[model samples]
Target: MSAAAHPREREIAADLRLRAARPPVARLSRKVLLVGTATACVAIAGAVAYAMAARPGAASRPELYAVGGPPPERLAALPADYAAAPKLGPPLPGDLGKPILAAGAPAPTMGAAPSASPEQQRLVQEGEAARTSRLFANEAELRADPSPSNVGGEPVVGQGARAVLDGPVDRRTVSPDRLSAPASPYLLQAGSVIPAALVSGIRSDLPGQVLGQVTQDVFDSVTGRFLLIPQGSKLIGLYDSQIANGQRRVLLAWTRLILPNGKSLVLEKLPAGDAAGYAGLEDQVDRHWGALFGAATLSTILGVGAELGAGYRDSAILRALRLGTSDTFNQVGQQAVGRALSIPPTLTIRPGMPVRVLVAKDLVLEPYSG
Candidate 1:
């Protein structure tokens, strides 16, 4: 009669005691889970792309853009005819409807034949005739205006140049005359030359002074017996630093002359020349070709890189960044090229270059006692 002796209890205990050894069940790895998730995402993205591509719409129509939300489903109803609809404000004092209709009418074709009553045609013809008469009268008045007489009938200037040179040229008598007297016995007159050699080198990168030593003695023009300027005199001048493209000369002019005897003369912008009487000095010119070529090469590379960086599938942010970068590069390249072009050519004249001073006016000076 005890509970431990029950047959059902004994059977349950026997079932609990029974056990078996089985093989271990495998688990999914992190790599497999990640790969499965990635595959599902790709399939979903592909389905969405296909749906967008297959959407029904006219190609020529404007593309659909996202809005804040769908348009109100229950909008206020509009009247069947807008013209018959009631206006909110009081009526204007003028006949607004008539003016609107007239404005909307098609404009008359230019130069078309008149299509009107005979009276209107007559008025239009009279108006045109009056305008024609006025124009002709104006032309006649212009012709009748007083003008200078062409007595000698000299050659008429061509029509194209009439606007530029329409006035009568003044006539003056030019007489040949000789000098009443020479200004001074020691005068070094025009056409006299002073030979000199450059004492200081010339580099046309900036505006600066140039020095030269007189290589020979200069005598008076009248008698050629007195020495006006002594040898070894210093010539002070300035050379033009502005260089044009392909230019090979250095233009310089003497402004002062200093003699070895401690005397100086202010020469009036006396031009300097080479021994051959040509204006300006010939020397080496540095065009900065290396810098120019480098800028050009860099510009080409930047332009090419900008074009290569663009792609079809790029996002808006990437596209904007690319565009900004490209613009910056293009601007920088253009500026570099401009800077290279703006660099003036450097002209260099070595010392001892033979030069000449051509006297353009009389130089009255005491004969060099030395």
Candidate 2:
């Protein structure tokens, strides 16, 4: 300010002051902004973490026996043979429509007198027949080659070791009185006892305690399920639906068992028709129908329309019978069959396939020769 305070000196000092002011403003502003953003980011991150941690039972759901897909490491172990074990049952499906002939038809007026539509009239007459029609569900067994590779086809596993019995089939199970083993021994190991249910009704009909005692060595529990291996001469007899082949009237049926890899094994043949014949629906009940309307005013044939609701169209009358829901079916002749034959449903040899099934309680069979 004293000696060098000339014009040039003053200008230089002024410029120096201005430059210092600019640095502090920019630096300070940046520091404040950066700290604010960092604090906000931390707060947001903490909130997100807390929300995620506070949720309850995020994994809550039915623990399906999933396969081929990996579940959590901590998940409980499934039955070791769960995928390979065969299931002996299957369930059902549906859809619906309304009256084609009547619009305001009251729901309460199903069969009040008789002025019902042709279908309804038929339904009423059949209602009585429904009660009259006798339904018999039974099972029969036959031996088939379990080893497909023996026939020389490359042994490729198409399915898991578990057998599956799904889809509709016409068949019946055998009463215990008839599940006797042959006097001869071949494939059947000695002493396989038949199921007690099998003998319940048959016990009264067979010649002796001999029938139940005949085969005590053929049944083996596979993966916790009772399975019957054919004892050379032992036969499973049943009544079933019709199967058409090329010019041959097949009184029985043999559906393919799909493996995990999709390979198949032809399961044993059950009697002509039965719970056993329908590989998968033994767990199902049957509701039979019959009609009696043939005249100038009506002239309707008896019909058995199984499913009657929306989404239930595809449900089997068999499955519906098992379900026994009002909307599932309308029947007069409903038969409750007893447990007779202990036939193993077809094994699904296919690998990696997961099947969800509902198994109804086993049925109880009493005696009936006619």
Considering every candidate listed, which one attains the maximal TM-score?
Answer: 1
How far in Å is the alpha carbon of 117 misplaced in model 2? 94
Worst 10 residues of 1 by lDDT: 130-139
The regions of model 2 sitting more than 4 angstroms off are: 1-252, 271-291, 294-370
Q: Please give, for residues 1-370, the per-residue lDDT of candidate 1 as tens digits.
A: 6775698888878788757646899988999999999999999999999878955665766649866666554544655578969877544335564454444456567896658999998998896565444222354565567354665677566733863475446575775685568888989888889999999999988889999999999889999899989889999998898888888999999999998899899997899999999999997889999999999999989988987989999999999999998998899999999999988888899999999999998888889976
Q: Which stretches of candidate 1 lie over 4 Å from their true place?
A: 1-176
Q: TM-score for model 2?
A: 0.14
Q: Please report how far candidate 2 places residue 105 from its true position, in Å.
A: 95
Q: How many backbone clashes does candidate 2 have?
A: 75
The C-alpha TM-scores of every prediction are 0.54, 0.14
Q: Clash number for model 1?
A: 0
lDDT of 1 at 191: 88
Clashing residue pair totals per candidate (backbone < 3 A): 0, 75
